[model samples]
Target: MNKHIADTKNNDVIRPTQAEAEAAVKTLLLWLGEDTSREGLIETPKRVAKAYKELFSGYQQSPEEELGTVFEEVAGYKDMVLIKDISFFSHCEHHMVPIIGKAHVGYLPNGSVVGLSKIARVVDMFAHRLQTQESMTAQIAHSIQNILKPLGVAVLIEAEHMCMAMRGIRKQGSTTLTTTFTDAFETDIANQVRFMTMLRSGS
Candidate 1:
C-alpha cells in the first residue's frame, strides 16, 4: 500500500452542513437576481448543492487508496505503460468554471504495475476538484510516482478552460497543454521522443 499524505489543515476544519450549503446556493441565485421562490427555481439550490457534492467529491477520496492494489505477476514485462485520452472535467479554482480535458499518462515500471483502471481513477480523483491545469498535472504525476515508485512518469494534459472561452478575452476553441515528466522521461531524449511519437500515432 502507498503512504497517504496527511492533510491536517483541511481535516481540522469543519465544513458547513448540506442545508447550509443549499442556503448558500440560494444566496447566489438571489445575488444573480433570480427569484428563488419561483416553482422552477425553488428546488434549484438543493439540486446545485447535490451537483457540487458530486463535482468536488475528490476531497473525500484518497488517491493512494485507489492505487493500493498492485499486481507483480508480470512475466518479465518491463517497458513504458501508457494510458491516453482520459477525458476529465474539472473546475478552475479561480473562476469556478469548467476545465474540460484529456490526459495522457505513461510510466516505466520498475518491478510492479498497478491496475490500469486505477490510473484513470487517479486522474478522475484529481479532476473532481477545483484545480489549475498545471497543479492538477503535477498532482497526478506526483501521486503515481509516490505510490508506484516507477522508474519514470509522464503526464500530459490538454484542456479547454471555460474561464477563457466563456469569459474574459473569449477565444473559442483555444486549448491549453501541460506536461510533467519525471526520472528517465525527463532526462532521456529517446524516451521523450518515443512517448510523443506514440501519442501522435494514436491520434
Candidate 2:
C-alpha cells in the first residue's frame, strides 16, 4: 500500500462505521414507508451498506500509487500513446444515480511511460467518487500529467446520467461528453486533432 492509501485509511476514522451506516440506511427505509422489520426488508439496510462500501471503494485507493511505477525504456519511441473506449460507472454527487461512461485517455511520454492498465485504474479511481463528469475528466488528466509528468495528457469521457434519464425531464438516450487537455494537448491544435482522430477511429 502507498503512503497516500495509508493516510486515507487514517483519515477514515472520522467517517461512519458499518453499524452506523446500516442504521442510517434503515432510517431512510423507514422514512420511505418501508417496513424495516419485514422479513424481506430486515437485511436490506445491511445489504445497502455493503453495496455502498463497494460503490465508494475508490476513496480507499490512491492515484499516485496506481501511477507510481514508470518505465523509462521506450526504445526512444516518443509520440502519442492512447487508450480508447475504457468503460466506467460512476454516480452523480447530487442525485446518487449512475453515470455510465467510457473514457479515452492519451499522453505524450517524456522519456517515460506507465503501464497501460495504470491509465485504466486511474480512471476507475476517479469514477468511483461522486462528482460531475467535467470534474472527473479534469481530475484524470491532471493526475496523469502530475504523476507521469508527461509532455501532455488528454482525457475524454462520454456518459449518460441516470439522474436525467430517470427523473427531471426524463430524457433517455442522452449522453454527456466531457474532455480535459493539458500541456501540449492543450496548446497544440495538431495534438488535439490527432487525439480526437484516434478516438474516433476506434482502432
Candidate 3:
C-alpha cells in the first residue's frame, strides 16, 4: 500500500489523478503475481482507473454546492422534515467494496426547506465515495445543516459493510447503524423523540 494514503488528510476526501490511480493498480497487479504487461491485461490499469474515477466521483463535488439552491416558500409549513429509507451505496475506505444500505434523515425547518429529491441527492453524493459509515453520517448531516441551515439536522444510516461481513469477523447478519445530530436535535429530547418516532413510524 502507498504510504502517502496514510499521511494525507484534506477533510472532504482525496481524489488521486489518473496516473496515480493507474500506478496503484499496476502495483497491485504485480503483487498479485500476474503479468500486467500481457495483452489481455495491458489496459486493465486504465480501465480500473476510470472505474475508480466514477466510483469515487463524490470527492469532485461539493455537497454544499449541490444543496445551495433551495426554496423559501414551504407553504408556511412548520414540522419535522423526514426522509426515510433513502437507499445508498458507498465504497468502504478500507476495502473499497460496497456498503449497501438505507439512510433516514430528519430536520426541523427554520423558515426554509430544500427540495425533497435534494435530500436523496445529498445522500447519494456523499455515498459514492471511499468512506467510513461514521464519516458518511457526519458528512451528510453537516452538509445539509451547512447548506439549508435548518433548525436541526439528524441522520441515521443502517448498513452492511462487506469489509466486515465478507472478511474480518464474517458475520453476515450484523448491521452497523450510525447516527449524527446537530443543535436542537442534539440537546432537546422532544425534538429527538420526534425524529425517532418518525423513523419508527416509517419502519
Error of 3 at 28 (Å): 0.7
lDDT per residue, candidate 3, 104-187, as tens digits? 999999998888899998899899878999999999999898888888999999999998888888888679999999988998
Global local distance difference test of model 1? 0.92
Single out the weakest 10-residue window by summed lDDT for candidate 2: 1-10
lDDT of each: 0.92, 0.91, 0.87
TM-score of 2: 0.94
Candidate 1 per-residue C-alpha lDDT over 1-203 given as tens digits, one digit per residue, 9 for 90 to 100: 23344454387756777787788999999999998999999999899999998999998888889999988988878999999999999999999999999999999998899999999999999999999999999999999998899999999999999999999999989999999999899899899888888887973
Pull out the clashing pairs in model 1. Answer: none
Q: Give the TM-scores of the predictions, in the order they appear.
A: 0.93, 0.94, 0.86
Better of 2 and 3 by lDDT: 2
| TM-score ranking of the models | 2, 1, 3
Error of 3 at 69 (Å): 1.2
Model 2: per-residue lDDT, tens digit, 44-152?
9999999988998888888889999999999998999999989999999999999998999999999999999999999999988898999999999999999889999
Pairwise TM-score winner, candidates 2 and 3:
2
RMSD values, in order shown = 5.3, 4.2, 4.1
Best by lDDT: 1
